[model samples]
Target: MADMSALTEAEAANRLMRLAKLIAHHNARYHAEDAPEISDAEYDALVRENSALEAAFPHLVRADSPNRQVGASVETSPLAKVAHEKRMMSLDNAFDDAEVEEFVARVRRYLALPADAPVAMTAEDKIDGLSLSIRYENRVLKQAATRGDGQVGEDVTANVRHIADIPQSLRDDAPDLFEVRGEVYMAKADFVALNARLMVAGQALAESKNEAFDPETVRQFANPRNAAAGSLRQKDAAVTASRPLRFLAHGWGAHSALPADTQMGVMQAIGRWGFPLSEHLRRFENAAELLAHYRGIEALRADMPYDIDGVVYKVDRLDWQERLGFVAKAPRWAIAHKFPAERAQTDLVAIDIQVGRTGKLTPVGRLTPVTVGGVVVSNVTLHNADEIARLGVRPGDRVVVQRAGDVIPQVVENLTREEPRNAFVFPDHCPACGSEAVREEGEVDVRCTGGLICPAQRFERLRHFVSRGALDIEGLGEKTIQEFLDLGWIDEPADIFRLSQHRDELVGRKGWQEKSVDGLLESIRAKTSPDAARLLFGLGIRHVGAVTARDLLKRHTTLPALRALAEDIIALRAATEPLPDEPPHRFQARIDKAIADHIGVENVGAAVGHALADFFHEPHNVQAWEDLLNEVSPPDYKVDVRESAVSGQTIVFTGKLETMSRDEAKAQAEALGAKAAGSVSAKTDLIVAGPGAGSKLKKAAELGIRVIDEAEWAEIVRGG
Candidate 1:
């Protein structure tokens, strides 16, 4: 990590922006998708680095900081979503004993306890499984949900009914309205047996079809935690019933009445009510005793039936917990002391390049099958070309791999970098489509420039087109997209609208009934008049995210207008190049300013303009765009501006919002016809400040702008 103190404000801001995006991506993978690209240690390191930078440069914190987020959103899940009565927050992590000590000392300092005063804490194994919340009413189970983005979760009531470890009814003494929060896990033996069974089933099915079986094509769970999550999250309760799963209660969410004043007391009560509690759960009066217990649990981790990555320590007194409250997404009175990642040596047999949906080439190191943290590791992510160069890993080299948190396997070190052999070479052309693969300026990733032609990119692009944020075609999931792509039924976004032509054929296919076929076609047809901004975003254009698409559409009003502007920008750039005697930087700046002026949209700068221009410059892209437009007619983009005091005003919101997310606050401002700016300036009309309001607040005061609390802002909104 770079020295936080040494970084300039601009540098810190840039790093924070990158860190925020990186963390959000990883959070979505781990929380929502049941897949993680990086190990827990790597992810934690990114968070810690972000925290260090934020601490040093508090004023430069981005709105999308990882510190402000908990779990990822479940907007894309097929299951129905339910809002949690109380938020399901994550725990802060402590990697070393010193950090753990600091946590205890911080708690003591917050409560203003004397040095000798004991602070009782409960320590329990941090199970590496899916987080679940089971709600009960009148001692009967009502609903079960998987924590999704803290505030909301996917309803899994039917699935949980099949897990024997989870009781349908609590004891008569239990609270009538209680939400039991815990981890749903699969035992190590069951995980192994499950994988074996999946493999056998795949082989048997292939043989029955008189085809060769490819293990790579078979869906196997990455680890026990993933197996447990994938099993429990099944849409079919029958599938969940077939899996051997268990649950252990760790805490309670909303409750009608408290059964105990201390955390341990409530956990004991939960245990007596038929929910299993961790056997290693213990209460300690001081930091020393808690650390000792953590170490003891770490020692027994290998022998445990289920996977546990760390030990969670929480203040035992419920009153103290309430007093400590929460900072961002974690409680101030608790921390998870994590164990070191498990490591093993393996041979790097080969390096394989996989192209992602966005056309970035990722390198995967094929390793000689080895065991790490009780799981067989056949491959490890090399991340990209830069990582491969840094590790100096090539075929026939020994390497060290680790599975941190028993999730993703990563190559940490190369044991034979000094060996006299040829270094692995990164491809300069897309392996899938033979298109030129080049790294962009200031970027480490080598991406394919194939656009809509590459097979890999095409499949991913089609999948993204039907994603939750895009057209949201109900029955068109990744698997279904791949199946259609394989059968040559769909090739581009426009082709999806024409899928009804194959209705009869689709009905005859295995797993496709007449009702399902009709439903899928209906879902696709429903998007014929989709949201203009969503359709633009669904095109998977480079540098055009959902927000950017909305901003551009808001300015241009229609897709055709946006395309015309893009073409105009292209013409303008071609007509205005560096003069013969002019400096390159000066000429570049002039053209950039011209493009920005032409677009005339806040946050839509020269990068987006150039991306738009470059996209339209390609004849193939223009053809694709026209084809898509022919299939659908999106209405002109318009913001529903309500007449209000803030209408036609520029508003800047700073600090932490307690009741809503930053995006929600910004959307509310937009709804009120206010332009929500990130930074305060002289032209700002109002400043909605929350707790932790820092430099922006000072700036607003210096500019003599009207400032109000979140409650006041809410009143203005309500009145409007």
Candidate 2:
């Protein structure tokens, strides 16, 4: 990891902004959507980075900082809303036994109890599932709600009533007015069976409709936790009724009466009252016994019927819990001991190079089928060639594959130390298109130069073209593209423009209606000539990102002019005589000279030039180009700058913008013809400093650059 101290104020500010957005996005995907994209450890690393930066630059903290936020976006469900009487707070986690000991000691210290005093705690399996608060009045289950942003939740009372474990009417021993806080989860066996059943049903229905089945669309839960959440939140009670979901009472919500004093006693009381309780729940007198129970559960995690991410330990006595109440988002009295990721040894059968939409090659480890964390693992990501090299793993060797939070398997270590029969050789040619796979300068991953020629890149490339960041054809998403591609109605990017040609054909498809079909075609027609920058970005060029594409388009105006210039520069460089003793550095210098001398496009470099040249020169990609252009004629790029105070000047923005995103701010500056530099330097004509602006403000003062607030920035843009 790089040092945060070494980061400039501008860099830190930008990083803080990016971290805020990334963490928020992952939070949404993990909490509200029941679909997490990254592992828990990976997510933790991001949080740690954000924390480190914030600690070093406290003045730069934004209003949307993840440190202050609890859950992701509040999930707005189709079901009725239910406000939690007592907030369903999450537990602060302890990864190791030392942290567990500290938690116990913290409790003891807070209560001023002696270290030798028996601070009892109940250790129970941490069931990974959606949190539910079931409120009962007069021993009758009144409502059940999901933990939506802690304060309010989606009411699933009708749906939860169908679950056998969650009794509609509690037993006589149940408290008069109390809520049963528990996890609504799917058993491991049930999750597998549900997926299998859905897959079989999907295939039969697809066959009946004379179409292919997509098992993913039918049941795409990555784990039992996701499955449980998805199943429990169904709007239709009948849908929830069909699935197997079970609940285990753990604690309480707002209560009028108590059946027992200790935490274990309350849980036992709930269990006797017909609500299911975790069978692993046990009371321990000290930290060692609690951790011992945690370790025992960790060993049994893989073999359990359902997934258990860790063990939870709460101070057993109710009085102790009251004294050591809640902290920020979690209970200070309760701490969860998270188990490390599950791992299993599997034989590596082969290394497969899979090409992505952008033509980047990824190595996948084909492993002999093994089960870890109750899920079957047949393949793992080697990550890259570097990973393969680092692991020294080869085909026919045994490797340890780990499954953490993600369903995707990863190679952790190679167990077999013996040499391979034959050394594993990474192919230099793309298997998808037989193109020269080149590892570009300063890039770790190797990529196929085939571009649109590669079969692997075709569909994905088009999908990227119409994506929100690109042409943004509103109704045409990935699924629609897939449907079009499958029916041979659309193959190339140009085919999207001609979708109206097959409007009748599209409308006939089961899910495609006349209104939707027409709407989709209208969106395609509206994007016949997308903004030059977006079009260039959608091309999936090797090194051309959206920002670079904008920079290039701002300079070249049109795709043809840019292509002509790029090719001419490459040809001009080819003709230029190389230095007598040409090394790699000299070669780079020669190309740099060609770009600087022959082509004076402001920010064009060797890598961008090479990518553009290679893209235009490829025959199949050229064919794709002609086909696309023949359908939709593109206009020249034009930035009509209205005379403004900020126009045609170099501007630097620091800290949080009050009204717009950083990207939008940069785009606005560019539209009015200002160079939005990332740093504050002597060349800067203007600096827009927002609240929490730190080092950049000082730098602007030192350089004597005019600094203005975000309001002033708006005024300048408004031609005030």
Name the lDDT value of residue 553 in candidate 1.
84
C-alpha TM-scores of all predictions: 0.77, 0.57
lDDT of 2 by residue, 456-482 (tens): 887789888887667888887778787
* lDDT of model 1 at position 103: 91
Task: Give RMSD to native, each candidate.
Answer: 6.4, 11.6
lDDT per residue for candidate 1 within 1-720, as digits (tens), equals 887766544445546655776788899999999988778988998999999998997655544568879899999788999999999999999999999999998887677678788999999999999999999999999999999999999999999999998999999999879999999999999999999999999999999999999998888887999999899889999999999999999999999997899999999999999999999999999989998998899889999999999999999999888767776788888899999998999999999999988899989888899888876778788878888998999999999998786555788899999999999999999999999999975456899999778999998999889988888889999889989988998888888988988898898798899999998988888899999989998998776767668878877999999999999999999999687899765676688778878998764556667779988999989988999999999999998765678898999888988765575677678667787898888889999999999998888878899999999999988877
Count clashing residue pairs per candidate. Answer: 0, 1
User: Measured by TM-score, how close is model 1 to the native structure?
Assistant: 0.77
Runs in model 1 lying further than 4 Å from the true structure: 2-28, 49-69, 72-80, 101-120, 162-164, 189-222, 235-242, 284-289, 317-320, 474-524, 547-623, 636-720
| Deviation in Å, model 1, residue 502 alpha carbon | 9.6
Q: List candidate 2 segments past 4 Å from native.
A: 1-89, 105-120, 137-139, 148-155, 170-178, 186-236, 242-244, 253-273, 283-286, 296-306, 315-331, 353-361, 404-406, 421-474, 482-514, 521-720
Structure candidate 1, residue pairs in collision? none
Alpha carbon lDDT of each predicted model: 0.87, 0.78
- For model 1, the local distance difference test gives 0.87
